[model samples]
Target chain A: MLKYNFKYEWLLLIRNRWIQVLTILLFILFGFAAYNGTQKVKMRTSNLTSAINELQIKEREILSQLDSLEAGHELNISRWMMPTNPVVTGNLLPRVVNMPPKSTAFISTGQSDLFAHYVQPIVTGEDSTMNFKEMTSPTQLLFGSFDLTFVIVYLLPLLIIAFSFNILASERERGSLKLLASQPINIRVWVLQKLGLRFFWLVMVIIITLSLVFIIFDFDIKTNWMSFITLLSIIIAYTLFWFVLAFATNIWIRSSAKNAITLIGFWILFVLLSPTLINQISNTLYPIPSRTLMLNEMRSIKSEAIKKQDEILDNFLRNHPEYATNDSKQARGFYQKYMATQQLIQDELKPLLSEFESQINNQHKLVNASSWFSPALIVQNSLNQIAGTSTGDYQNFKRQSIIFSKEWRNFFKPMLFKGEKFKKSDYKNLPEFRYRYASVNTYSKTFWLIIISSLILFLVLTPNKHQIELIS
Target chain B: MILTNNLTKSYGGLTALDALNLEVKEGEIYCLLGANGAGKTTTINLLLGFLKPTSGRAFINKLDVVEHSKLTKQYLAYIPENLMLYPSLNAIENLDYFSGIANKSFNKKTLQSILTEAGLQESAFYKPVSKYSKGMRQKVGVAIALAKDAKVLLLDEPTSGLDPKASFEFGKLLQKLRQKGVATLMATHDLFRAKEVATTIGIMKDGQLKQQWHVDDISLSDLEKNYLETMSYNTIEL
Candidate 1:
């Protein structure tokens, strides 16, 4: 029966132009989305490459000057502007710290469009001053990029509803269902076979279109085959979830229009409403302090710290007597006092910073704990994880790069305070930035949840074998 | 091949079939005659296991219909008043699909032959049923019944919309199936056709069988008079 149903349904769908129309639609959607994603990736790569190349050009000139200085040549540059000085070198020769796109980054724009891919971390800049968000239009953020995840998580279910919503209802409406019920078979099995055939065809079309899109966009499938498979699994599982809903609605609802309305209602509830509600609740429950208020607090604290700079420096020298040399000139230098004052300011702002961190962490915890209410959020977040552009991914990058920035600053602090000359070999020991993705097994969770939900819906709608009546 | 044992069906104090005891054996055409709401269609639905009996049982091929609904359906073929099929499917394709649904696979040649035997014109064999007339669709339904080789056939107003000639032709098809040892229970208002085809006839009114007779004992006009008298008598009793 399944085989016959497959053969006939394929013929019917093709004759009805459903297959041709959906294939074209999916191809256009995937093609456009892949193009957009690759464009974003291209821009980031271009920015990083240009930054690195320009830095190389500057480095060559600086190295020539350093060689001249090492040969006992005197230059007219100012004290602070000279590259031979360790403070000058640390402040001027900052490396381009960047987060490169992952192998499957083209699958989803996710939070990538919202954040900057690269930052120049200088010794003088504070972690609080590291802005990771790029300057993007609010309208663009409101209407997010068209990506493969958007197509799968939002639009594919609608297509499934359009395809399968009328399967049973149309039979009953056309008066063929009575004839169908007379056959020596369970009605639910009949419905299951019909829906299964449609699912099979739609999955095939999606896989083909997505593969073509990937090939056209140069997705590097040979290197990221596992991620590609995961992407396909997520898509198939999500498609089944919608197909199961269509099956349930077909049996439970009596009218084709009603079935469409009910399935569409489910789609909107799960895809659009639930995530917004969750986000609203999370924000309301764990409210973070306003950035404006935080800025005011930082300003007042810095003002207070500047007034007490001399006091904090004296206290610091008294505690670390090793730095209190016989020549008080070195002890009373501007940076020595400034470095001590900066340390005091950072220490004083610790509680305020920790407050923000704890609150934001609580919000993320809320989103994670309640994401199961909507399968859309679950699949979207997982796809974002595959692309390495989720909010968590950017947060991890921001945290690591901040730590490296502090380390880079601290490495130059000792040289600056001692008024020591920066040598050519010292550049080799400067800290470099490396980004490590957050190790998360998010794929299996979404897959299992969606698969289990679909099976449960099937079992629930079909009931025991041969129980459905021929006529209502 | 068909039996109803004191079968009763009611919905919320309104009885649709009341303690109806009846039987139609091999090669017997039991035509049930009734006005509207006479439990004729109700009885057919009950025998098909479409509605569970309230107080008794319906059996097909000696198997309790409720207990072995799908198994009993293996030997049964049903055609409603409309004989609705997939409109997009041609007559031969419709026969093939329904027969396949019954787990009886036939080649295209055999299906076309069965369609031709059922009196459908060869020219219309491949035309979609959406373009078919009511009588033409009924012929395709008969083709499906023939293709399935069903032993029991249930028809509800099976010839209601046919012309006189088509109605006479359908009577002949029923006679042919009867000759093939198929048991038939047809519910209709066509007294003349009933007297022509039925071996035994029953008259029902207000969910109860009012009369039973062998058609050999009555004429066509006499049966119509008897049907009118029984319904009027039922109204008087009500």
Candidate 2:
């Protein structure tokens, strides 16, 4: 019976033009989404490359200047602008700390639009006040990018509903259900086989279309084959979930219109309402300190440190007497006082920064704990993880960059306090920033979705007295 | 091969079929005639196991319909008033699917032959059923029953809106099935078709069987007159 059902259902769907229409629709949707995603990735890569090239050019110019000065040539530049001054070199030639986009970054635009891809962290810049968000259109942030994740999470379920909401009700409306019920087969099994075949065909269509889109877009599938396979698995599992809902509705609802309405209602609840409600609830429960208040507090601390810089340096020298040189001829410079004040400002801002961190962490925990209420949220999070553009990824980059900034500042600190000259050879030992991705378990959410879909399918297949009685 | 013993069905305070006892044997055609809201359709539904009887039992080939609903369907084929096949499928394809659901599989050639044997035209066999008329669709339904090798048939107003020539063709198809030793119980308001095809006839009114006859013993005019009298009597009594 299953074999026959599969054979005939394929025939019927083809003859009805369902397969052809679906193929064309999926191609258009996936093709456009892939194009958008790849465009965004290209822009990000270009920005990072340009920044690196600019930094290299500056370094070469500085090295040439140092060569001229060592040769005792009278340079056109001012004494303060000289590369022999460590303070001048350190403040002018900052390293570009960047987070390179991952191979699967094109799959989701996630938080990429909300944050900066690279930052030039200078020695004088405060680590606690590093601006990670780049300049972006507020309107663009309001309406997110139409990447592959958007197509899969929001539009795919609607197509499934349109394809399957009428499976059994249409038969009953056309008067064929009487004949169907008369046959020596369980109506539930028949509905299941029919929906199952449709789901199989739909999954095949998605795979083919997505593969074609990827090929056309020159997406590097060979190197990222595992990520691609995980993506396909997530899509197929999500499709199965929608198909199971369609099956349940077709069996229980008596009219095609009502079934469609009910399915659309479920879509609204799961895709639209659940994620928004969860976000709102998490925000309400674990509120973070206001950004304006933290910024104002940081500014006040920096102003007070600047006024007391001489005292701060005296206290700093008393704490670290090794930096108190025995040569009375060593004169204290402006950088020495500024560095001490920067240290004092950082120390003063620690408690407020920790409070912000704790509150934000609590919000993330709440969101993660409640994400199970919506599969849309899980898919969104999983896609972001695969792309390495999640909030956690950016936070990791910021943390690493901050530590490197400290090392960059400390490297110049000793030279400034001891009145040592900066040289071309010193460039070799300058600290470089490297970004790492946060670890993610990509398959667990997909596994849970499959399990939930299977459980629903089991419940739908289980015969109940009400269903039988309703059939009669 | 089909029998009902004191089968009754009712809604609260309203009986749809009242203690209806009837038997349809192999190689027999029994036509049940009645007006709207009569027990003819209810009896057919009960016999098909689509509706469980409130009291008593229905059997197909000595297997109780309610207890062995799935097994009983193996020996029976049904056609309702509007015999709808998958509009996207052709006559042959529709026959193949319906027969397949009854656990019968046949090659395309066999399916086409079955459609032809059921009186569907050769040209119409490959055309989509969406383009088919009422009579053409009914022929496909008959093709399905023939392919299943059904021992019994339950039809509810199967020829409600068919034209005269189509109606005559349908009667001929029933006569052919009757000769194959199929027990048929059909519910209809067409007294003429009933007389032409039935070996035995029953007239029902207001959920009760009011009259029974052997088709050989009653003329078509007599059957019509008796049916009208029974219907008008109920109206008069009310």
Candidate 3:
């Protein structure tokens, strides 16, 4: 029975040349998106690798020069010159801990465009300036990429709705509903079979397109397994949601034109309007603190600590009495210690940072919970999370920035306090930053919540066997 | 083999079919005659299970139309006034699609023969319906009903838009279906066609059946006069 239904569906679809054209167009778009994303990943990885190697060579040259100067008894002069060269202080090299694109990354570009490519860690209280512009332009961020994820989450559902919204209503309008109803199969089963056939076609296209992307990109097979599965699951559930909606709408609407219009309106509301509206509301609810305000606060703390350097030093010495009887030169070097004190004050403002971050996270939680009503938004959020290109990724970078600051302060403090010359061997001892990828398990609750909600909605909205009510 | 007892349908406040009772036996051509809004279409819709009666029971072959809808549908075929077909498909394709939905599959030769038997021209059988006339579309509809091998056939204004020649041909086709033991319930305003094809003719007015008679019991001219008088506001003491 199912085979016959499927064959019949294919015949109908073939007979309607518009559907065939639409299917071909979707396949082409999928291929194009995957190709572009793979190229972007390869180009970015190559650029970062070349930059890192060049910076490493520059660092080696500076170290050799410092060694030569030390042998000629010019150590003090070389020490003073170190701060002028960014390479000597390791400030030029960005601590880029990249979460490289997975095999399915092409499917959803997500927040990759909006975020920074690499983050550079600075020594506490040095320069205190942030670069506003990076490699990409703001225009690119605003006009997001047409990646695989965008195709699946935004475009695919529309296609499904367009194809399926009038599945039954057209029959009704054309005076064939009675003929169809007179058939041996149940109405609900007929609708399911029709939806299943279309979904089968859609999934086949997606699987083929993604498989091609994987091969072309030479994606790491073992590591990207989970991301691939998540991508597939999201696509399936998202498509199913739209199919079910079309089914429900067809049952209620009396005319094919009305069904198409209403379903398209629903598609626009959920996919396009809801997420954008929620994002705007969230931004208003938890506005990120102005970068200027944060910079001003840091500057004020630094100047205040510098002006009362003697008092701060006295307090520190009293607290750690073991250091009180050290050389007077150590005590007199309060100007050198002022930067560390200012860093301490900045660290103390952590509660304020937490408050701000918590507000944003709360807004995210609100949006995530609201996915019960809009499956498109849920699928989109899930895709972004799996791609490692969300706001959460930025938060992870911020945390890594703090860790890098601590390492930088520790690396310099020993040399500055003990009055020892910085040697080439010490450079190897400096901590290198590495970013840890958050586990997909963090989103398990959200994933299940959306799945359960969608199922519950399907069950609730679906009519019972005994109750056959014509909507019009 | 179709029956309705006190079948009533109302659209919000207006009653389209009011306490209407009708019975169609196997091999019977029951023609329901009425003016506009006389509940002829509503009766056909009820028998077809397209609409539920507000307060009555409708049965097809002893199976309740509402309770055993799928089973009832298996015994039925419906052709509406316009006989709309998938415009992109030819007559053969349209017949195949409708029959396929009813789980009936026929070979190309059998389908062509059915189309020919319904009086569709050989040249137009393979051409897309976008070029087909209203009569050609109705012939395809009859071919679909023939392919289904339905026990009951329901039609709404079956010959409303056809020319006299086409109407005569359709009346001959309905007679052939009657000989095959298929009960047919048709709603039409064409009194002359009804007189030629129907075994039993019923006149309806203001959502009520005013009269029912076997063709042998009433003369054609008297039936036409009675139908017109029943439709208008006149005192007919008969």
Superposed model 2: Cα runs more than 4 Å off: A328-331, A465-472, B233-238
Q: How closely does chain A match the true chain A in each prediction, as TM-score?
A: 0.95, 0.96, 0.85
Estimated TM-score for each candidate? 0.95, 0.97, 0.85
Each candidate's fnat, in order? 0.53, 0.83, 0.37
lDDT of 1 by residue, B4-91 (tens): 9999999999998899989999999999999999999999888887777889989999999999989999999998999888777778
What DockQ would you assign to candidate 2?
Answer: 0.77
Winner on TM-score between 1 and 2 is 2
Rank the candidate models, highest TM-score first.
2, 1, 3
What is the per-residue lDDT of model 1 for residues A1-472, given as tens digits with 9 covering 90 to 100?
Answer: 6656766788678878999999999999989888888888888788889988988888787777788888899888887778877667777878788889887887789888888887888766667778888888899898988988888899888889999998878888888887788888887778878998999999999999999989888787898888888888877878877888887777777799999899989998999999999999999999999989988999999999889888988887777665555565545666677778877878888899889888989999899789877789888988999899998998898888888888888888767655677777787798888888887567666567677666767575656533544255
Q: Write the per-residue lDDT of candidate 3 for residues A401-470, one digit (tens) a residue.
A: 5567667766665555454556666667767777676665425634664465467457735666332444
Badly placed stretches (over 4 Å) of model 3 are A1-4, A35-47, A70-79, A82-109, A122-136, A182-189, A213-225, A276-293, A314-335, A347-374, A441-472, B6-15, B18-21, B90-93, B105-125, B232-238
- Pairwise lDDT winner, candidates 1 and 3: 1
Global lDDT for candidate 2? 0.88
RMSD, every candidate, angstroms: 2.8, 2.1, 4.3
Q: Candidates' lDDT values, in order?
A: 0.85, 0.88, 0.73
Best by lDDT: 2
* Lowest lDDT 10-residue stretch of candidate 3 chain A: A124-133
Candidate achieving the largest TM-score: 2
Candidate 1 whole-model C-alpha lDDT, 0 to 1:
0.85
